[model samples]
Target: MNTLMVMGYGNSIAMSQILVVVVEILLLVKIGEPLECKRKEIVTNTPVISSNCYRECEYPSKPTVCEYEFNVVLHQTMSAHCGDCPFKKEDCNLEKCVPVDGSSRPLIAVNGSLPGPSIVVCEGDTIRVKVTNNLQSGAGVTMHWHGIHQTNTNWMDGVPRATQCAVARGSSFVYEFIAEPAGTHWWHSHAGYQRASGAFGPLIVRKSRKTEFNSNTYDFDLPEHTMTLTDWADMTSLDIALKVNIPALNPRSQTVTILMNGKGERIEFFDETGQIFKTPRQMFEVEAGKKYKIRLIGAFIAACMTSFHIEKHSMTIISTEGGEIIPYETDYLTIAQGERYDFVLHANAVPSAYCIYASGYGNSSCPSNATFILKYKSSPLNNPTCASYAVVPASQDRDQYMGNRSKGMFSAIDFVSSDPGDQELYRVDLRHYITLRSYAIYKHPKDPGYLNGFLAVDNVIYTPPLLPFVTNEPDDSDICQSTLNKTFYYTCGMKQCVCTNILKIKLGKVVEIVFLNTDEDIIQHPMHMHGGSFRLLGLGSFHTKKMTLDNVIQLDKEGGLLRNSPVKAALKDTVMVPSNGYAILRMKAENPGYWFFHCHTMNHGERGMVIVLQFGEPSEMPKPPLDFPRCEGWEPK
Candidate 1:
């Protein structure tokens, strides 16, 4: 009487005799009859190797998706110390890398190249790079497009924990974004410290030559002339980071060698065997009497301030960070990390090979130097006798470039922006002053042995959130708003203030961000802001012995602040804030999304020198894709 009905595909059983009926139904399905069901098949698109690798980018009449496949994996240099490079065997393995740096250290390569593959496209073209993390070591990776304005496609920015999660091992991620504001740019790893292990390359966004700002100044702009400057070491970035974080290790982790376009002679600093081998150098070919437009990218991971100069030639800088500037000639260029310069080199010297020199400049820098040959097309293949390292500049003073020692030296203030926006940043709606400093921060309040060096902005170490802010609205308990309750910069000094530093800016509001490098021990920091370029208002040291935010504010109110050319200030995304000095930047918060603002120096940035800039409201931001990879904090469940 207490019967229950159980439903099957085409039969029902009463609970009174359920056990007997279930056994009968199981026998019927397994032996007596076949169950009818519809099976589904799933198909996944196979990644294809595009044959357009390294081909010249065309300026398309209409925008199109420039898809690229990036297979990131652990690779090694060819043979021993790249001695067997330049192989021409038809059956030779293309996956083997040849850095030509005379070191067979392990590297993380993209598409089987040291500097990876260059992404050259026209402005407004959509770039879709499907990155497959092929590393068998169970590592994750992400690529950041340096100097790219993500605009409505903020998720494609490639900053893990800020924009999106890392592409996990054996997984793939498709980064799709529209390229705009054509200029010399680059792409590199934003995860796993893999960029220093040779995971970066040039990214040139081209527009019509006729529409270029300083087009008439140069006669030719070739793809081969684009050079990437980087610092290399025999050890991996993780080893260097370990030595740096734990200072008691007596860190000899400075630049062992510098590379130009992934070519350099090996330096045996860490090589205990002291084995040296001859390695080939990069050669830039030029025709006689032709003015060549050379695009230089400073992609260094170290804190080395590199100065580049070509012997018997002068460089006329026309543009910086993709913005056209008033042309100025200089004997050499002192470039920091994450900076780009487009200069015109007039091949006026006699038809012969000349040494292009690059040497480290400033204090706290090692004697890291590199050389490349600039040879005329018809010249013989001979090494120049004068192809030696140039003497490093003795003057460590950066601000002295404006005074008596300014000849043949040009900084950002020396050149003015030729074409600025219609709305000048004469005044701003909000102002935020941050002091760039490095000091010891103990992890625990009562523990002194747990102290580690941390680079901070306004005494707050920027720790990235586990869940990306772009997709998830993290609770206030997750982020550390140190400045909300603080008034002065030195209040939290030596107190270990670490958190996800967030700076919110309203839409269309012009904001002024002043960087104060009042800390005497700290050197120059190349501060790079994401999303868009800004107006470089000023850069100079304070007159007082001890300067603070309040002091700078009073100086600004009294018109005592040293400023650049107000009308022709340079437009830049990265500005070098001098040591014991200051830098002023102004821009309108138009891009409505979360962006990164941090020191481009990888060592400093990794040790908490960063800030998250949230522009506009959540409603104004573009929504991410439905199937986009989502990440969150995972507690011990």
Candidate 2:
């Protein structure tokens, strides 16, 4: 990347050389989103509106200063419009950053966007992103193109230990891959709590060619209609980890705010002089009666399951994790971390203001602070007359969505016939059953002190890291046989282990995995798998009266006959393993790579719940980037 940039910028070249340089420059500028390590906005001891704010401000950037009331409409007036693009190679520059959070605390940022820059690319375009780690000391940074299913490029999977090592601080590496299976997706840090700092963004893949899912779907498919709903902890993930490093600090229970496209009321700026500074809110405007393709990317860090709804509007589900699904209508939807849903909203209500909301789903009480406004140009901005909607429990909503009858719908099973969107469907070649049992491995086996709650739980536990997990190295061992010999490593870490158990699958084989969550207390584990989109075969309580691995596998073996199993499953890249329950996911192991499968809830992943899916002969896989960064010892020490 440096060579290309230097060569492109050099002078003293002939006319032909100059033309080549100009073409290269345009290509680089077209592909890469140049991110600055520092904010374009100037800073001061006192909170001040950035001088460049008016460049996007609706009122003026000139002598006449407009009051803050004009701020609400600025986002609409200033959003960058991505009109069109020819499918071609592209470049992106992502700088690791430490910026202030909504509450004005130091946080991580990428290219300055609180939630990072939303990447727009057409299906089939190959992209190369140069990521520079500019973060403060202690932590390294690496960005995972979540749900991109990098095909044969496993080295770019972005798991520090599983694929390539973390791109160390001050160093830069180029992440190049093909963007396939067009739909709503995202990118985030694969290391530490850095993701919580603002290192997250949407990865939207447009269809390769216009078809039903594209042209005939809705009236509007503008970039502005999409949003990345993110959760921000009042404290950084690193800070929380530090607190947990002490004897016994309770894990962060939830995020302080749920930001829509990285803006919310909870995110406020204040002057050093103690006066409150107004923060902009994300507002979506619509004509009174038109259908809009509203892509919702669930980019979360702390929260697991989130319930999203737009008051008085019905959202029809179109796709999940980048695969088109039969449109299903619902008032509210519950999604887990690393999940993406592209739905269509019918703005049929009267011209007025309505709130688009999303909140962490756990206890019946909902933290409804993360909200955005939906209004029409004809509606009154002040004293919006829309009434508040009641907060509903996710379990109730989850059951409703799961129990939804697939009769006469374009569900996954119904993909038997030819559909352009149904490009990648794997036959069930080899089925494997796995269960994730989350345990709070405390520093002490038996507690010597008493506390109000389970605050003594140390680091969230995971299986130990498979030492020396080199990116190019492939595990050709028989994983199934090793499991029987008790040679598979799972409990190596007992507490805070990074050991990864690699599940090897033959290329072109269809695989089904059943994940059962056994934590009695923490039931919702947002499981996200890389490299492939799996079908949500089924989700229910344990097959037997008790939750056992044997019973779960036995039940999964009979999935074809189980009454609860869907005849046609829905394709999803992420799903919340129900509390005390299990979910069966099926996908084809056609993409050869070392892909990590883990709980999207970062806490559980940090502990040891992660494992790798190794497919095909590694010799057939692409080599690691020539400039791929390496940790001190990627192989086991």
Candidate 3:
């Protein structure tokens, strides 16, 4: 028999008797167990103060108090390079700067710097930013913290004309508030286009808690860098305005030099001596297996699609203005104006030093500035040749991963001409025409004592008309037309024109908006809506032509276009309208509230290229809340 045997620590049993012997041995071992092996009952301790009954204090002032201090001053100095231009000169052109006080003379900049100090803080921290205006002119200024959910802190919203009065020149205003929501943001002057003249800076909010995916650590371990893109015009802003308003003058064709950070090393026009300005180029050193994070901020007047690449390293887009996305790995990423992106690069085995390149999208005249560099550690492997480095294409279509299909189409208008046989498909509930005008500094009769020109919609200076739809009687039409044209002199104001205020549409009803850019100014204006996005139905030139869906569509010399594009996804916020053209935006007013509609150009918005949306039950109310401050005697007592 195949005998089975059971063996214990020091004893063995044969097959037939193994089962009986094993049971007996186990029983003896169990009975001989020590007392320490016995189970014991556990009792939980209770707290004296009950956690279940705890409640948060309803009072606002009971929390721990915190304070922060900051200061602002103006100094006089000069830099040869203006933005990303390669030309360096020894001229301090103060006239080109926006006056701190609404005056004729320009103020010397703070620290003699364009784009002032960056305000950095962590969430829940109270920040006190002090501004002391030392310009010769007594100007009023205000700062708006963009995208920083002001909520009830409307006092700090910083609309100079809409909120509180501008901080007087030679005076100071203490902006005290708690920073909320950690992310990338900016602050700019709300008192006219002072921001355009170098009154802006980064407003960073650091995370309060320890995050699993720490961007700061990622930034510290690898090469870290930043780039701020801005557009600069050669002429004083005032002159640019005058040219834009006067059709005959047609001054909008001016070339804009895009600045990277504070560097001027891209465009050839500024490099008179042809000597490369190497100071602006950025460089970094990295170990073969290290990682890097690059922060890009588009603060310019135009929208840009950027491409970034290092020879062999793959890029991962970690975050956008909307916060972190499901970290996507890509060769390159596209970013638009008023947007920020954080990308990570794992430089594993790149072999040799690789040049990181950043370029703009479309056929932009603006060239890319080498704002930073990435250096690799020495390795025994053969050095990688420059030819072996993967080059990132500037165009989205050319990118093998991005593909060539257009993201969206363009449309200008959606209306059938009034012909009796035509289907009365839709009635015009709100029919109005708006004409934007820019004027020269000296063109204004009032001489607000500034170089900048005045802006108006429909020949009405500083007055946007109300909507719903009204037509003037023939007899009254002639007189009204005459007053409008002669009142501004900027445009022979034509009467029987549409109003600017109160664009009324049926609740939840689909409506089309026809945007006409009559200003001979050739500068493209990206018209963005705050609450919703629309589809481009059609485009029209001197000869009307049907176009495709495009969120940012350029308008041509003569405005005409059809709306036959398919319905696209509904998005919220911003659309661009090209110069000398028209854009037709279609939207269904679903969420009702007051929304801001304006041009994305920083200067244009300050010059009155903005209006409000009033959505709700219809009313015969004469005017909406023209929330202008009482300073200029425009507000009612």
Candidate 4:
């Protein structure tokens, strides 16, 4: 068998492959015989240490008192199968799966549940989070608090290997920081492909008292219901990675059917048999003439641009990504993966149920899904049935209703722009090109590329690179060593080529990203970033000048450019880049820590369309404790 080893600095070098094999042998001897002996062998040979030693042992101690105090925790658990399964009964056994912590289970989870937990707080509040690792085996775990501004607290930003070592099995760590510039955000696991398993939750920060009142509102009521949409894959995260990146194991295409918190099996509604079965897909109800804000979070792995319509009533977008925006009325609003949109709908027409549907953007062939009825009561209007009503498309024209006088009325308060004097634009310190490649089941000469017809970035098919930045945290020596081997190379010279460039941004800097889609693949990619949102500056094919500002602009379609001509304005987080096209985006690096930038499409991210953004100065960042037990033999040379 192939052996994997880790060599320590000098004294007491222990090989990981040998240790694992020895432990496995011991386990085999005690299996079905003596339970105590098996337990002893496992504990003595394969000990589980407090992986959080670095976090707990850090020096200079955390501040005794801070601006705010928040408490949160992270726990690990097992799931039998993927949450997005139509058959719901196919639980991927946690016991037989590999990868130690049972993380290889078809649906192992962080915090013991799907959609994790909701973290709600006001702006400026100091928060403290305590994460507890509870899986059977050691599993690397990290958390990126989507858009919160915790400058210089990069180490505390949970990212396995990059920010610090993985939280050891049955260990805990405290993440403390202050929340700034409130907005709708999320948190997810940074470990290898774990986020796909279901390790994410909502991070909503309420607006400050001043900002809340200034927007001309009285009582601010939360949504009657909050819906998080996500796509589930049936295979284990590791298996998915192997199938996508490995050159000899080509797999079939996967599809998702269940929609959480929508008209799906998750909801328990009464059926004709008087038994509670899964609720059927339906429309949502809202009161006519009354204002209601719907918080839509696209937790799916793909990019989705949702459209809402209620016959004649128009919709107003009040907030996005948790930040307040100038209230503007429109027919439809687009949201992408890891993106959130909070819009207020004024139920002015006849009281009835409105159809709220989310359509998949890009080259998605998946059919759109619908939600339950939005009942508009408190009026003498009759409820319209589905047969008599027709669903209207979200209006794109902003000038039709408000007229030319309100053209730039709310432009000033729309989005936060960096001040020229305080603008800190840093040069692109680290540039890494990314690509996507597929591998077929066996090494066949006639196979188009790695996987049947898969392409590659540069010369090699893409594989997720080890996140060295977060992994080699605290220790300058190890960090420097990893950085020295930064430039990556792979082998993919057979078929098409599709690569992406990743830039490391400094905290508190304005970054301009230019994307050149070299027409390697025919499908478009919806590129998304965490933390701050970017404005679409320009977009066009390789032949012409860039087009106008659009959140989602289709790349070189067979029929001219697919532009949202009506809503030519800045968007919150998601944007689609056409195939073989070019696009540019401008954003501010307000939040510190390691953030993820990746393609919204699940298949693409799995095939290496993802990168990391390490914000903030290295000097100001905190270091892990000195007493932290190093990985068995992972010391610097």
TM-score of each: 0.85, 0.73, 0.53, 0.61
Model 2, range 1-637, lDDT digits (tens) per residue?
4543324444445556868989997887576434321123334433232211122112211221111100000011111221110011010111222122234456565655556666666555555566777666646677788888887677776777667767766677777777666678888888876666667777776663344444455777777887887766666566755554433444555346677776655434455586554344578988888889888887776634677778788777777777676667766676667877777887899888888777675543334546678888788772343344534542354332243333211222222211332334434666666656644435453365421222111112234343324443533341222233332333432433332356778887767776666435344667788888777766665422465555556655685324223334666788876666767777777777767778787666675566667677677566765655544444676
* Per-model RMSD to reference: 11.8, 12.2, 20.3, 15.0
Q: Rank the candidates by lDDT, best first.
A: 1, 2, 4, 3
Please identify model 1 stretches exceeding 4 Å from their true place: 1-61, 78-95, 248-255, 267-277, 387-391, 396-405, 442-451, 480-484, 488-490, 542-544, 565-567, 633-637
> What's model 3's lDDT at 115?
54
- In order, candidate lDDTs are 0.76, 0.58, 0.45, 0.47
- State model 4's lDDT: 0.47
Per-candidate count of clashing residue pairs (backbone under 3 Å) = 0, 23, 42, 49
- Which 10-residue window of candidate 2 scores lowest in summed lDDT? 69-78
**Candidate that beats the other on TM-score, 2 or 3, i.e. the better one:** 2
Worst 10 residues of 3 by lDDT: 466-475
Among all candidates shown, the one with the greatest TM-score: 1
